[model samples]
Each structure stands twice: as structure tokens, then as C-alpha cells.
Target: MTYTHASPEHGAPERADDVDDVARILQPDGTRVSDPALDRWISDLPPHELRALHRDMVLTRRLDTEGVALQRQGQLALWAPCRGQEAVQVATAHALAAGDLVFPSYREHGVLLARGARPADFVLAWRGEEHSAYDHAALGVAPVQIIIGAQALHATGWAMGAQRDRSTDVAVAYFGDGATSQGDVNEAMVFASSFRAPVVFVCSNNQWAISEPVTVQARHPIAGRAPGFGIPSMRVDGNDALACLAAMRWALDHARRGEGPAFIEAVTYRLGPHTTSDDPTRYRDADEVERWSRRDPLARLEAYLRDAGVLDDSGLAEVARAADAFAAEVRAACIGAVTRDPASVFDHVYAEPHAPLERQRAEYVDYLDGFSR
Candidate 1:
């Protein structure tokens, strides 16, 4: 249901700040713009950590590129490309602790990579061999949610439990710009605020949610919606990895400290088509794409690393080689994935063995056996 008017008790629809002026710590050219006194708190990450983030970003892109290729080659049913939002996903993902949980929207390839989801896990699922490539317990992440914004409620409920346990762990809900319009997301925020759930609503506002631009959905910034829920909200340049990492760290810290939920709207662009089947060129202008291309997160971070002398030409060469190798490995896995038996799809439909499900599984078995005969 579209929320035309929130309750008056929420207070005159709390005035929204100009989100275009939201705080940002990193420039497109890798220049720092954060407060001088809080330099260490913001961008003074350990050298090794920073280096690792860069590599992970590159690897994420390589996986994304290969995933698209696999889909085009008919190895996978469909693919959601995360081409332009790598920095947002990688930085926010790395900010979480090992025990924290993540509920990702379907296109969270970068987050899945940061959470240690291998190429095999992704390919096997896309190849229709399994329900998902990830094991929740091992990865500390839930299965990808395709039913838009449903995971927000899950995250909120999980965060309530975490809060009761008095644990520092937090629950993160990752969704796209379009999710804000979902009733599930709004209801989740309402419950989270009322109960002070320890969750962070991380919205990757990549400008376009499929064919609909963000402007078509909301009149104000998505972040502004949180204020009405009594949750602290902020916007970050999603293309700036450094800014995203710092913002996520701060938001996680707030939730971990029992300060209730936080909301982050990451401003980014989607460089590729929404999915393998969607054509973005029909609705989007070429000039807009070109403008955002100049702000490519990887190139920005690459410039920063080179400018700061953190990486030399040889180091850059190694990164390129590593990306290529990683892509090849993913391609091999996708091609080698085995098809799952059709009956297996019904194996876990009912936890306690519902009679109807059993009948269906049996019928499926009989159907497959007939094909063999």
C-alpha cells in the first residue's frame, strides 16, 4: 500500500533536509573532505585493510562482469548486474563484524563476495542446481530476497532478538531505492523504531530502480523517510568507497551501542541494464550515464591509491592479473555446475513432511522416471 499520509503523531511529516548537501568524506578524485580532527576516525583505516578493500572491489567487478557473460551465454537463467555500485556494497559489507547478519536484495553481488560467497555458490544457484549458493550459518547472511523489501522486516525482527541478547552484533538490511516504496520496508522501520531494534537500513539508491527513476517514486530523499520513523538518517556518496565504509562503521556503532536503528541512503548510479532482460537505454539518457561514468568508484579509489603511493605500477599490474584469474575461475565454476534433479526442488518445501508435498515429490519422481523410460 502506498503510504500517502503517515500518522500525525509522527509530527508534521518531519521536515527533510536538503539531501544533496549530505555529509561526504571522499571526493571523486580521492581527495578527503572530512573533519580534520576526526581524520583517524573516518579514513585512517590500517594500510592492509585499505589494500584488501581495493582488491575486493576489483574482484567484485570481475565476478559481476563474468556473471553477466554467463547469463548471455545461456549458462544461467538470469543475472542482476551490480556494475556501478561496487564501492557501496564492498565498503558497507566490510564494516560489519564477523557475527553480524546481512539481508541482501538480489543484486548484492559485492556484498555476497565480501561475505565470502564463492563463485561456485553463485553459479550453482544461477544454473538452477540449488536454491541458493550460500549457506546462511557459514556466511552470516540470509538467502537473496527477490520479493522486494521483505528482508527489511526480517532484519528488524532479527535485530530485536539481537537487542534482547545484549550483543554487539547488528542486522543490516540492504535494499535498492525502489524498496522505500514498499509497505514491508515502512512497517519494518516503524517496528524497528518503536522497539529500538538494532538494525541498519542500508538503501543503495542507485538512481534507477529498474526502469523507474528514484524521482518517480519519492519527492524527497529516501533517507528523509527515516526521520519520520524517529530513526537517525544520513546520505552518503555511494560511489565513494571511503565515505561508505566510514558511514557504515558509524551507523553500525550507533546500533551496537543500543541507540536504535540507523538509515543510510547511498547515492549511486547503475551503469548497466537493470538485469539481463531489461533495456535501460529506452528510458535513460546517454549523457546522464556518461556523467556518472566519470565518477566510477573503482577508478576513483585507484587514483587515490596511486596518488598516495600505496600502489605502484607493478602492484597495479598484479591487481589486473588477479582480476583476470578470478574471472576465469568463476567462469569455469559456472560451466562445470551440475544440474540438480527436478524432484530435489520439493525436498525442503515443508520442514515436517507435509502429505501434499510428499505426493507432489512422488509425482515429480514418477514424471522424471517416465522421461527416462
Candidate 2:
């Protein structure tokens, strides 16, 4: 029932050929490892908070499962599973302050869940009902960006604005390893470096990007790319919840103290396909998936908590019941969802009405009237 995760020994170089150049604080078998450098960030976390972390991961997995099911059952257009990246998403979100902002790629369901996204918020866009169901300013999370790596620039720009106003808020961008290869991601790093903006670039280096493996994107560690941009970066075992929490805390502290942006390459695996539209069997080996499954983020954290006396059999059952209830709520919300008026698509295309846009809207209305005739 415990995990035996591979934790790198100390003194490994940051830029290396393999993922061994990573930091970890928990072993796969539920044993706690020591990392003097990173321990301070999470040393004071109370038992209740630790238990909460476990619950968050559990709920996130359930949400992911329900989302995939919804898509399969025809309630959603598509879904992106976070089967193995729960620890990274939940831990990083917990590290954020109320004023901090999140700019996430479309797959960051756990992050949005941790940030209090409602079930309807999660399904609105996937159901083709709205641009984004959640309120961006209110949640402090920007609308999901389907365009790969674009959120990096958005986060950097938001950070720059915060800097100009002398606000203490920081912004974090979440993207996959494939996004690191995109021009927008590279350009965002350049601007963030030049301006010393208070932003954190978090790359969940889930080994595959659609049909391509991580090897196709970078010969070296993704963490290595940030230092060249004059930013400090770290690679952490993404399956280790404690390690991820510690790493994010350190990065957030660095940004909050007026230092330049930092980067985190959370070495994780994509246990599922890239999205509901993808098929891993086409390019991924079954044995490889089996290997990564042994390092399941939820199981790893559950083992750790059980050993630490923070969770028992009853506690585990309670968490499961909560997850089931949450999933059911999400399902009901999606099933009962209502679509918006077709004309509403043009409502927010511009901040104010324009003559040409109004004309286009009128034309569209006339086109719709043709159906009646």
C-alpha cells in the first residue's frame, strides 16, 4: 500500500541528462527523507494541514476521473486528466497567497480545484456553454488558456503590472514540458528576466506531450533552461507532495522578496493520454505506464500520511466519501447545465460596441431568422 518513490541523493547537479537531478523529501514507501535546504518551508505545517493536503489530492483525482467520464458520456467536448500530477498542482496552489495570481494552461484542473473552482466552473467551457465559467478577478485565476505556453506571457505581463503599481502580488504560470519548446514561452522568459518581474514559471514536466515524449522537447533537463535566462530554477520529484509544497514555497518567497522570477520543473509522468482526444497506446509503452503508476502521487501522499499518524482507515474512508459526493455534484451540475444564447458569443468580443461588430451581429441574427423561413 506504500510507495517506494525514487528520491535523488544530495549533491546532484542541477543540469543533467536524467531526472535524477531532482530534489525530494518523501520516499515511495512512505518514509520521510531529509532535505535541510528545503525543509524550512514545510517544517511548520501542522498535522491538520498535512491531512488537508491529502484530501485535496484525493478530491483532485476524483474530479479528474469525473471529468473524463463526463467527456466519455457526452457531457463535455473534452477533458484533460491530471492522473499523476495531483501533488504538483495541489501543493503549488497551497503555496500561493490570497493576492497571488494564477495563469494556467488548460490541463491544470487540480490547480483550479485547489483555488476553489466550482464544479460548474470546471464544466462550463468543456460543455461549450461559456468562454470560462469562473470569475477571473475573483478567483485570482485567469481563464484557461488552450493555446500552449501563452499563459507564460500573460503571467509575466500581469507580474509587470503589479510591479509598476508596487503591489506585493506575484503571478505563477503553469504549463507542460512541450510548452517549453514554444516561442511564446521563450519570449516570456526573456521579458520576465529583463524586467525582474515577480512571476514563477512552473513546468509540470509530465514525460509526454500528446504523442511525443519529453525527450523530443529537451535533451537536457527543463530546469536547466531557466538559468540561462537569468532565473533560478529547481527540479523536484513531482510525485512527492511534501517536496512539491516545499519547492513552491521557496520559489514564492523568492518572488515576494523582490527577486527575479524563478522556475520549477516538476518531474512527473502523464499516466493518461494528453487529453480525452489523445490515445497513449499509439506512442507510449504499457510497461512505461505501469512503472509510473507505482509512483502515483495520491498513493504516495496517502502512504506518508498514514505512517505519520495523520490518517487512518476511517480517515481514508471519509476522504473517499467526500470525493464521491464531490464527483456526484460535478456530474449533476454538468448534466443540468444550460447553454447561452447564440448571439451572446459576440457580447464580449469587444469591451465596447463597435459599428462594424454591431453590423456583423445584425447579419448573424438575420441568418438565424432564415431558419424560421
Candidate 3:
């Protein structure tokens, strides 16, 4: 689905009134807000488009589940599950233009998938076979940054480039709430505001950074921090696909109109371990998981569709079949990816060859040859 550039006359100005309007539409109790503009926006979306969002959430959830299984089976070194956070990734990425660049944290497999990165490509990364599985220039996606908040710097730099070229394309940086404490993240905000860079800083505030709860990071809401950096910010119900889509649309529009960077804090839960290597049960309560399960993105969207008569039992069964088939394919690719060469570690180190690296590469090859004998 594509979004057109919204003119000032097309929608209400994003002020206190609009914020209140959006908050009403996204109330947690499923009450419908009375607004012609909001109703029209929701009603204008075709059933197929809504179903597509459902499919993306289902497929990405399945991918995260299978990835966990692969790690358990010793096929991957590690895996980060975006289990309950699918809406933040899928809806936000879907709201972007083809020309926009995405700076992803390592856990944003769903974003990569939405940006057209194949399942095999993502598998290769977790299999520890490649730092990045695709050409960033080709995909308009940066390599997944493992160092928390580092991608913010790269995203800000890319935004600067877009501004210099007078391009309308925006850049999006995906990071967790934990990254907010990082110096690089703060620096990126400074640069983005100072230059009024066309970018969106998307914080998937899943409420944890590994074992730490978000309360340890900030006493107030994380979105409130954006205004201090001279950027407008909003909080969206990350479990609600429609809310995420709307918030992302607003952020992207703000960027495209030369209004400078906007911040989106998607309030969601990470219903799984930080990674396959970590056991969340030790740190978090099972009751907490059960609670968030009630607010599951897939279930919420499915309920919305069923209520609207957009999806039925038979349709859900078909989606299940497709999800299963896709998961099987991903599993097969991930298993194969595990056996690939551990070489090529020296290939992309530098644009110009380094003498020390060359020597080390020769020695490594000789050591491997010795094993053959």
C-alpha cells in the first residue's frame, strides 16, 4: 500500500486537538471515536489492505517463532524474537515510501521483511554467516546495528544527505527504549534537530532492554523526551496495527513536509526473551506474559477484521496454511545457512587491503589446509 503526500488542507493540523482526536480513536477499550475524518480514513481502507496487514503480522510472528526453534536446534548462534512487537515493525515500515531508508536495530526482522528482504537473507544473519545479508543500497535498508543506538547516527547522517540533495525521501531509525540512554542516540537527536533533517526516530518501546524494565530508563513517558530535542513526538498503541499505521503516517508526513524529524514511541510488550540465549522467565513474571498475550497484535487485528466482517473462519484457516508453509521454507533455509563457510571474514574488512589482515588471512588458510591433511 502507498501513501500520498498529505497537504495542509487534506488533514487537520497536528496540534493538541489532533493529538486528542488520535488518542480517542486508539482508546484501549475498543470504543469508536466520533470523527468524520478518522472514520473516513478507516472506512476508505479496502478489506484487502487490512488483510495484508494481518498476513504480515502472522508471517512475521511465525518467522520469530521459527527463529527461536532454530536457535534451540543449534542452527543459529542467537535469535531475537519480535514476538509481540510485530505491529510496530510491520505497520511503521509499511507506511514508508520506497525511496526512504531504514536504519534497523538487530531485532527488526519484521521491518526487513516489510522492506522486501527475503527470509533467507535474515536467516543468514542469525546463522552468523554474514554481518548483513543484503545490499543496503539496493534495499534502502542499513545493516542491522547490534550496538544499541548506533544506527541513529547513521540514520541522521543519511537524513543530512537527503536534505543536501533536496530529496523528499525520509530516513527511519529503529531502536529500542534502552537506546535512549545511549550517547549516540542523544547526539543523533541533536544533529537531526539542528539541521531539521527529514527523518523519523522510531522507538519500539517494548518495555525492556534485556532484563531491565523501562521504568529503570525513565520516570516519565519516553516520547516526552523527543520534545526536549526539538522534535515532535507521539505515543501509539503498538499492539494496535491501525494506531501504529496512523502514527507512522503522521511522522513520515511531518518529515516529508520539511517539518524536521519526528519521534514515535510505540508502546508495546516484548512477550519473549531478549534473545534465544536469555530466559525471560527468570527475570519477568509469567503473569506479565499472559497479560500482554491478551493484547496481542495479531489477535487484536483479527478481532477488528472479524468484527468488520473482513475476515472469516475460512479465511483465517487459509492464512494459517500460508504461515505454516512459509515457516517450513524459512526453517529449511536456516538449516542450510548454518553449514556455509566461516571464510569471507576477511573479504569486506576495508576498501584497501591491509598488510596485517592479509598476513592473518594467509595464516588462517594454511591452518585450515593443515586440518585437511
**What lDDT tens digits, residue by residue, belong to model 3 across residues 10-47?**
45323211122222243444334443322433555688
Q: What is the Å distance of residue 346 in model 3 from its true position?
A: 1.7
Superior by lDDT: candidate 1 or candidate 2: 2
TM-score of each: 0.92, 0.95, 0.89
Residue 228 miss distance in model 1 (angstroms):
0.5
- Pitting candidate 1 against candidate 3, the one with the higher TM-score is 1
Check candidate 1 and list the clashing pairs.
none
The lDDT for every candidate, in the order shown, is 0.84, 0.88, 0.81
Q: Where's the lowest-lDDT run of ten residues in candidate 1? A: 1-10
Candidate 2 clashes: the total is 5
What are the runs in model 2 whose C-alpha is more than 4 Å off? 1-17
Which residue ranges in model 1 land beyond 4 Å of their true spot? 1-20, 36-40, 350-354, 370-373
Worst-scoring 10-residue span by lDDT in model 3: 15-24
**Candidate 1: C-alpha lDDT:** 0.84
Count clashes in each candidate, considering only residues at least 3 apart in sequence or on different chains: 0, 5, 0
Q: Per-residue lDDT for 10-113 in model 2, tens only?
A: 44433332655568898777689898767898989999999888888999999999999999999999999989999999999999999999999999988998
Candidate 1, 221-265: lDDT as tens digits: 777778889898767788988878877887888889998999888
